[model samples]
Target: MTGIVNDAGNAATYAYDASGNISSVARGNAAVSILGFSPGSGAVGSNVTISGCGFSATPSQNTVQINGAAGTVISASSTQLVVQVPAAATNGPISVTSPSGSATSSASFAVTQSSAPLIGGFSPTIGTPGTAVSVSGSNFQTTVNENSLVFNTRTALLSAATATSLTTAVPTFSTSGRLAVTTPFGQTTSSQDFYVPPGAHVVSDVAVTGRMAIGSSQTVSLTTAGKIGLILFDGTAGQRVGLQTTSSSFGSCGTGSLQILGPGGSSLGSTALCNGNYLTAVTLPTTATYTILVAPIGTMTGSVTFTLYDVPADAAATIVPGGSAVTLTTTTPGQSEVLTFSGTSTQRVSLTLSEDSGLGSDCTYISIANPDGTFLVPSTLLCSRNYYSNVLTLPATGTYTIKLRPYGTNKGSGTFTLYNVARRRDGDDCPWWPRDHADHHGSRAGRVSDLQWICGPARKPHHESGQHSLVLLVDFEARRYGPLSLRGLWEQYIRRATDLASDWHIYHPPCALR
Candidate 1:
């Protein structure tokens, strides 16, 4: 078309076959521009990029060299190029070239193996019957099933295993131990236990026999040869009953139901079903104080009863504030005794002479009266019903004393018991009351620990708002005082509660939750 032709203005051209082999080539000088030099091709495993081919076609070359290295060509153009490097190639610079120009880029490739699984922990460490535990581990696949692993002889459903973790419920009929863990790659073996001890005494109380009505209320005590089990008051049966134990190790309430009966053995409708292996308190349902009978229910067993009479209160003597002599006397058989007083007077309390008709040692009594009348406490004479005597503080303001005839006739005497009550120190400024009255009373007097008895499980069925009365029937009977004193036993319970409270603040286990 143009008359003026320039040899230097012509374009070059090339060509190739479908197999990427050079087929034809040409060079242009001026007039006619050579349009086909042809694009380059590569092998299947070859790294490639396509660029710089000057052709009217949008995609002239299907593939070409990637900086003379093997890779995958993602895209190519006249000005730039892109490729996925072969796994065998380390990160390096890449370029593409054609008849017109070339293009280059920085890239890399990589291959890696799967990761390992992680473990959280095993469960049911105690190993109890019918206990369900979980084995927590990470790195599991979603397509797990029975064919996955032999879990306790059963096909375990290969559970959902994710890139992070996996879970499966423990199979039934599994052994009482830990199980094995299996994965696509390998297997692991481990085990755990499932039981814990119920920490408490597993025993009960015993039965009762004769009962009597004391002072204002009808009461009864149950006494056996050894330890007692259940001590209940059957208001329905009009009987003060209890269940005693032959064996000291276990008792009735440990495994049974106890009820308070009325006249004719009819259920007073009070029943306490022992929920724990050992119980702290189980009361009798009766406004009238009665004893309870502990009986075994099902396979459980225990025994206990209520016995022993207790005096409500009595006069305890100490020097009066007006300097009057503190007169002390024993209505029952007076034996072991101790008297204490505190005030301003510094005079010794004398024995104001005791009169009794029963026989036995009378004058061989030990009496301790503060010479300066500052302080006189219980005499270490150990006075039982076997001993009898009277002690008096003679106008002693600050001191106290107790007289005890350890070996003597105690029956029919006006005073057959001893009183060893404690009082405030005399003459030390601060003065308290009730000097000598507790010792000579029933069983053990004034000791809060003597109360190991419960009253009733008598359901105060939900009625009108607050119509139910709290009927507490107590039966305090001695079985064996053991080596522990009443005061000591009470202290132990207090200490236990304190320890539990402290632990609640620490680990704060599930049971401690509100």
Candidate 2:
């Protein structure tokens, strides 16, 4: 036995065996003490650090019980022991037993049930205000006040809630945004934005009368104009709205066409020529009632079956110059994909269409139109294979619309590139000047003559001596040079002028020639 003084200045005695191993120690009846613990409350399986004195150095020898359940000790020291709350632990005192003795905490450790809520999916993903949408997931509380659902910035009213699902009424102020749910544990938001359409209407089995007369036409009334309307011909897909007659007296059904007339009988779009079967997609330009005029090429009489579906108004995707190529799919026959882009006057805009393979006999059609809805360049001929436009030079600077669709009953997928080409600007001199002059002479001459007439005299002369001398001689023999001679001399002057223009890079000719 040895007498010693503890760090606290308390008298202590140590007893050891013959091997000098300390078997027991007495600290004047000083029992194990628990000062306090961090995070006074925690859920099951939560790690807690209890700070106190009189604990075994070996963690396995120290037994820590939380809420009447044995806690697993992670580490133990003379003054501290880290333990994990055991399963089925309740709210009760935390007691620790060291080799010396045992002691209980002054306060009980709180055990809480907590878990983050999860969302699987929702019903009626989209709806107008005052719509009730049901959400399904897990870890929802049975208590109503504990759950919160929000659509965008507005908090929705919770009608009911379960462990796996929740029902909420869409708030009136909700906009097109994410739907989020918050619980005591955590919060989660939807992966996609809920779309709230502005409005919608559907018309079924609309009877369209096909007329044989050239001027005669039929009309179909629509509730909303300026919106997209999908028309189904003959109650089937991939069919055109027109008369189908077998009589030889009737011309080819391919020649039939329908014109969309505005409320006041104003044409909204260029006539959609029918190819026997038709499913036309049109955007009404006016809110007033509209009509579809059937203009068959030959005498024909038939009742066409059609259904009109009104779709919400949506802006066409804009494709700028040098932008990524756009892939267009003709999901339905005669379905048009509209694209708008800004173009400068004389900008060489070209479109290259490449059809997908295995699409036998299917053709793609592209049409370039002005902002006024008039076709700047009507739909090109059916392109069964890849087709490249003739490098169209924009006539003016404004927004241009490009419509892509499948020709006739052909429907498939294709990709098109709309990009600006770096073309040689127009001038008096030809790009291929002095080489292959004959081949490009006529085009160059026409361009120069048009520019000269439109923009007045050329800024610079083509030939210092020859062209000027010829013009002077023509004037000198004005009377002798007949209309035919004068015309011939004028042609020569235009040819020479274009050559000079090409060299100076004055203005670029229209893309038609390219």
lDDT of 2 by residue, 277-374 (tens): 44345554422223344444333333333323332222246778656777655544445566788988887776655666623255556689976777
Candidate 1: tens digits of C-alpha lDDT, residues 1-514: 0011233444344455778775665544522222311123322333343323332223445333334555555555543355554545433344444454433322222222333344455553432223344556654444555114333333344445554344445444332222455555446544322111111212222333333332122222223432223232213222222221212222433444444433223443333433212111122333332323444444443333322222212234543322333433433322333444453343322222233444222322445566474434444333222222222334444444444432322322322222222233434221221233222222223221111111112222232323211111112232111111112232333343233221111111111111
- Can you tell me which runs of candidate 2 are displaced by over 4 Å? 1-276, 282-315, 357-364, 371-376, 425-514
Model 1 clashing-pair count: 104
Candidate 2 scores a C-alpha RMSD against the true structure in Å of 18.1
Local accuracy by lDDT, each model: 0.33, 0.54
Model 2's alpha-carbon lDDT is: 0.54
RMSD of candidates 1 onward, in order: 28.3, 18.1
How high a TM-score does candidate 1 get?
A: 0.20
Model 2: weakest 10-residue lDDT segment is 477-486
